[model samples]
Target: MAGLEVPTWDPQTAMLIGAILFEAIILYVGYGGLEKLVGPRLMELLVGGESGVSQ
Candidate 1:
């Protein structure tokens, strides 16, 4: 019976990992921008207008 051998480094695997990482970064930035654009409006709608404390 043959034992399992360790896999060699492969460029294709590296590229796949890099693609996933790149996509994750893009999604993070997109969501951050969307949050910045809509977050205050959404908070005001939920809380029924601004707080009494001055900014």
Candidate 2:
């Protein structure tokens, strides 16, 4: 019987995973920034209000 083999470190796979993670982080931050910049304006346009509620 043969012994168990060790797993090899794959540089390409590591880089690909790292790049995907980095892109996800960037997209998250960018979306948050975009939401902060445009969310209020969009809400105001859609709701048409100087105040939060009419009450």
Candidate 3:
């Protein structure tokens, strides 16, 4: 039987993982910013005319 061995580290795999993580972080931040910037405008467009109306 073969002896157990520890897994080896690979630079390419590390870089790819790092890139994916970076991209995810960037997308999360960008999406949050975009939502904040556009949310009010979209809400206004959808519900703008009812502001002065009585319940």
Scored by lDDT, the top model is: 2
lDDT per residue for candidate 2 within 1-55, as digits (tens), equals 3678777879999899999999999999999999999988888888877544766
- Misplaced by over 4 Å in model 3 are 1-5, 49-55
Better of 1 and 3 by lDDT: 1
C-alpha lDDT values of all predictions: 0.86, 0.88, 0.85
Instruction: Identify the runs in model 2 with alpha carbons over 4 angstroms from their true place.
Output: 1-6, 50-54
The RMSD of every model to the true structure, in order and in angstroms, is 4.9, 3.9, 4.7
In candidate 3, the residue pairs with backbone N, CA or C atoms under 3 Å apart (3 or more residues apart, or in different chains) clash, namely none
TM-score of each: 0.71, 0.75, 0.70
How do these models rank on lDDT, best leading?
2, 1, 3
lDDT, model 1: 0.86
lDDT of 1 by residue, 1-55 (tens): 3668776879999899999999999999999999999988887887756653445
The candidate with the higher TM-score, 1 or 2, is 2
Say which candidate scores most in TM-score. Answer: 2
lDDT of 2 at 38: 93
